[model samples]
Target: MGSKRRSLAAKPNKEPKLSRTDAPAGLSPLDWQRGLRRQFGREQAFGLENLGSEPFFSEFRVSNPVSKSSYRVAIRGRGPGGNFCSCPDYATSELGTCKHIEFTIGRLEKKRGAKTAFARGYQPAFSELYLRNDGKRRLHFRAGTDCPAELREAAAGLFDLEQDGLLPEERFGELERFMAVASKSGHEFRAYDDALDFVAGRRDADRRAALLGQVFPSGAADPKLLAVLKAPLYPYQAEGALFAVKAGRALIGDDMGLGKTIQAIAATEILARHFGVSKVLVVCPTSLKYQWQSEIMRFTGRHDENAVRVINGGRAQRQKDYALTDFCKITNYEKLKPDLDLIAAWAPDLVIVDEAQRVKNWNTIAARALKRVDSPYAIVLTGTPLENKLEELISIVQFVDQHRLGPTWKLLHEHQVKDEAGRVTGYTGLEKIGQTLAPVMVRRRKSEVLRQLPSRTDQNLLVPMTEMQSLHHQENADAVAKIVQRWRKTRFLSDKDQRRLTCALQNMRMSCNSTYLLDQESDHGVKADELAALFEDLFADSEAKAVVFSQWTRTHDIIIRRLDKLGLGYVSFHGGIPSDKRPALVERFRDDPGCRVFLSTDAGSTGLNLQHASTLVNMDLPWNPAILEQRIARIHRMG
Candidate 1:
């Protein structure tokens, strides 16, 4: 058997003659012979069975001639980590190629009558070095044998030099070092035109770093910059604004209620004051469009009506509004689709996407339209940029800097952990991703900057009502309008008219809470859904607790259903619960680690020392300012 094996191996020593026609296209006869030599006559000796033919014939089975062993080869595409073979050498070599893979490639090349660049072996000109993306959508570095020794050595640890002289993309830190050496070495390094965004992003980062130093010499915005603002910023908020201004296009991902809107406003002021930014576009939820305009005016102290234009009305009207060229244009996400062209024409100098998570799904029309605006600078404000999936964060970041995370496929491949069924199970390399995003993303947890935080932060959330709720609300609103119209005509309201107005107002408020609160039948309303979503986030931290107050006990019942659905522990403190049991309810919410929610009415709103709760929710607004303050004080009071 040993002699037989030796004889078989010796038989491949004699060279076989072949014409240029036999060689794959773009491959010289000599190079093709060299490639065959490297294969050690495996193509001739081995038996290759094409497994599937569709879409590139990407699967093959190779049988070893001597050992009679078979290995499966999956042609994953052309790159360092693309192809795979169930063979020991292929698994351990890091060469991305093996004898079986070579045999299969040779067979496929002959069948197709042409060789891919990967199959012919990637070899750049002796003095040329460049970066290009492969079929797998991964960036690679191709260098020639005569490339400068310094450049090659510089890339040694950073790039994995493959058998085909292609180096796959790696961490940016090492790539930066390699490029620095190349720059100093006076060697011309080229990048594929389309792949040059990565290079441009790096250059932008360098410029931003320099600008950051110049603008924030003391690690915070200059007092002169702050002085222009109507309101003073906390130390951390000043840093956040400085970071956003320096980044040019950035995501401010501070926790909810950390004043992301104010930070973005401050950044816009800095840009206008120092960066020649006069026109700004603010895209946000429909309900918050006016709020954005109000904040911009209040913070910039530019109360002139013409200073900010809130785009509204039909398409033609919006088009006319877009032509105004005000200092700022505010629009909602829903309007972006129809007015995308108008926005591009307006060409604002800066874009602030408030509540950026609305565009977390890249395939959504709002996201697609917003992405096409193409402003010089962008700031994405999201309290929870990554509420669930990493892809959501990627989508949001892409809005500010599309190429910051590289191609989506490559990013997912590098980080996503998939199950056997090909579903993503989890993610890896999150820390590495964070490092890559450090330049364009500024995320400060409330805990991280607690010292700079105010004793209490207030936020007003606007939730859209459900279809049924809206229907009921509109009916009551129409009635109230009619009553006011009747009163205007007669200059007085009868007893029946006054009772009708009161009942209509009360019904409208109840319907806004939930349809079930009004009719006690349908459990449909957005407030309950919104509250559930809020609890989903608030309770993510085991120690986190919240106090929920509503003027009506029926609203608590609706909210309790949602809390029950979430399997969250809660204590209901309404008038019906009796005063004697109120203390135990508050005590349970304050002491029990599992009890993370305190549902209450006005009865439990005052004189409660429930400082353990960090979040407060109002199911429905109270008529009196004092009552609202009391409910807030339940959780916002001094610890």
Candidate 2:
């Protein structure tokens, strides 16, 4: 209804014969969405429900339900193509493209029951402006945007320039013409092309040699120090920590399994030792409190009773009276809110937040709690900075370093996070934020270091759908479908009935995955027994040691009892473990060699070296891949 006149397009007359796939009159039907549970690797706030009903064409607005901001990220061929997004990520020449764009296409496909170029194979459909015209020239103007002769001259100029040294170096730019037009706003072509040129120009780029040189440098920081003691520091780790210390506040963002936690802790330790700080306040999820405590003690080894204090859990009485002495006082974020005033009195000289992504939303209770942590020295540790969204960056940076993003969240969102295109360089507020952040945010991708790591053979264990599960899942789905159909035909349902219906659906799905505690009395929903059977196999694996992981601790309890009945030597870790008990449990598992398995959810399994257990199993998949990696990294790491 909104847009009328549309045309199929590709390099001028190369438009594929107009078909259903093409947007009709600039008005396109909503496409069906596939699971983006992997791309951005977080639960998308804008799912199929937010997919604009009218259609998608050149520029259409889709709002993020969580942040309530409308993002215009259309994939139509005209305007900016894959290079389009109103968000600032589209602005940065360094970062290319936004995750929100990939997310929307999935939701769009789900709504329309049609295929998106993205869902099918997004890479091909990505913006192609900077790709060598034939994937060779290294630069080319749009086929018709310039006369063929003008294009030839520009392309030659870029090729010729690449052979010389007229430019300093950056992403989102081609030889010169591309940089002249390329904006640093991510999700655009210039960022990729320009980055290729700039980074390529840095020596012959013997990456393996460069990386190893950094890690095993001459006359650097002490290697035997507790933090760098276990696995020696890579060059990037040492550089990232020092960079953040200089900037006052910054993100130590090495890729997952690249030792971000170690870097942050080591930096804090260095600061404390150098500055004569007495205490440290470490805030994290209610789940990973023990991790912070364990890391502090393991790395700092500062032999002070006050070296680490866990302020998390319902131990308000103890947390309130907790003393600080050159140790980390680890606490879950929830406690940070009610105990904010008390923390000031218990002020540790330094504060650090791990997996800081938990504070990515300013409105959350976690944010409210961590913000009040007053310390001259603060460190933020995270692996995936964007998680592919602008708001996540806004929320995280605000928590990590206030100065980098400025003070108020509103101003940052307005001037730095908002979607903007058709600007001077084609970057959005978020892209601007990234460019500003990159200098301070020390990030080294595993790709850059992957060559040096040992070869890891990845295997996907595709377990078949269980018999009862296959039967009952379809049964419940059919029932829900009928209810939805009935609702469509008649609006006569009572409010109480509708509320009951929604609750029933929610419970039905949860019960299907794991029915260890399924209440036959309460659930008018489907019950699948595979989950119970799986728990049986897990704890009953008497001869083989395995790690049992779950996203839900509620379900984890059911698993714990089942394992206990089997009389297996096992331990459980979650946000609940006390700091003192946590390390001892790990030691017992290691030294006694009697403890065969470990049970943990996302909270307890991160940032620890659980190298004792050999077999790892995911009882459930968390929404974020980073979470799963953090869990596995506990065991599958390089020393």
Candidate 3:
């Protein structure tokens, strides 16, 4: 056996010779060029990596210009047609390579001082672009008497050559617009090299930091608040607070569930500690005034009444609350509308607007009132600032950077798309909009920062409806279907038909929660029994705290009856509860461990945080998913 093996090893395996063709064929040069153009269009051809000589092997990591995510490719070839790439484009090709191979060749050509295709005989209209610093930064065009119309259109947002002598540097976004337009219109742009570099540097994170330093000097944190803190904040929260502090006045558009409250409080504390900001006014929805006060106390560890005040009650009482200027004050937007003058008189150093989208209509009393309130710096906090239209964003942005965004019509003309008839069609220039807002907007979604957040269990609990409830649902749905079918056929729906359809759906949903909602005399709901069972199971674990939400106050009433029958101590929060008393109710439910259930309606619990409770149950789903998310967020915030 050993002799046979030796003989076989010695003999060449000449049955067939496997050549490089047995391996998959590579992409052709033309194919590689096409791929290169595709990558260039995506702005992914900018990265060059692992460039080595001798036995050359090149690796490149390209990024999505918009998403900022990267993809890598490796090349192993001498040059041109001989190069092969590890990317799928090359590997799967029978006679060619990938964009990486072409990019590598281009880089090699550039290294050899050979003028690339773009450089050969390309002459720009402008000979130079100069940035002048004379109290204000300005970009000056030179040697361009016959500038292209596209360049003029792209730079329209900057400054008109006829109206203003120089383009403002703060409108650095115009530089990007110019580059894009230049690339598309075949207008050369290397002449604007210095101006482009200057604008690019302004967009860097360091630039934001420098701006922040100018607004809030370094070492501006309050020692008293810092000393009393129970635990350190998460890195993102700390960074957010620092960003807010640096910007002085800005928008914290962090997606919901990212702890905007703590960030706002931290900044407020810093302003109070370092800038002699004795009066920090917080304007939020009526439901969130208490939540803001709670966060301030919890984060600052100031258990005293004077630590934070919720401005509420009679005019006389509110006057007294305003008189106590040594502490941070929280008030709802509506309340401030009537007393803007009084609040403005106090001259708060910082004004924080929670759920800032409430003032998205600049003409509204809330927005006007917010503008009237005197504050050196302001923080507008919201998850959805641009809810429906770009104009809405302009409204909120007006509070922080009115000079940057300018007038609403001006902003629309710069960004909005128009048709041949000059009617607004859609929006353009979004990239420029981002650049303008970059200086003052800090946004991070939960996906970006919640690596350490406790795993959330999302369960759709299917509660079986009773026979009567199911029958009612089917009838109501059928009725709506008929009305919709008629409108679909005729393309018109009368007011009576529309109202009837809406009422049918409303009654059906009410029936799902409890038949008692549809008929006050009736007294049964499958959800009530489900809630009772859920309560029993939760209370069995003794430590369980639950926040229950229903869309209807009547449904809450039914749940209240069920809980009372079961001898469960609970607190109910709904529209019936006075605005002033809501805070005490929340406190009672949170502190009293024996209070296993806190009942609330969507409208009642809109902005309150009840995270002390570990569990949340929705008795019935709302029409808008955001309302459900809002309900769950009350209990699902960072510790």
Give the CA lDDT, 0 to 100, for residue 522 in model 3.
Answer: 75
Q: Which ten residues in a row have the lowest lDDT in candidate 2?
A: 29-38
Report the C-alpha lDDT of model 2 over 358-411, residue by residue, as the tens digit. Answer: 455667876866765776556777665665345566667765544355423223
* Candidate 3 accuracy as lDDT: 0.67
Q: Against the unseen true structure, what C-alpha lDDT does each candidate score?
A: 0.74, 0.53, 0.67
TM-score of each: 0.65, 0.39, 0.43
Query: Per-residue lDDT of 1-639 in model 1, one digit per residue for the tens?
Result: 355434333454544554422455676533554454345534467887778654343568888778888988765444334455766444333345666776676566555534563455533433333333232233456555557888877766666667343545446546666666767776666553433554665567677678667866766847765565798888888888888888889999887668898999988888887778889999987667777877888889887766988898898899899888699999999998889889889889999998776555778988878877888789998777777798888878877876577655457767989876668889999999999899899988879999877787777766666678889999999999999999999999999999999999999998888888777888876677667765765565678898888888888888888889989999888777777878888889989998988888897556887888898888778899988988887777654
Q: Pick the candidate with the highest TM-score.
A: 1
RMSD of 1: 12.2
Clashes per candidate (backbone, < 3 Å): 0, 53, 7
Error of 1 at 170 (Å): 18
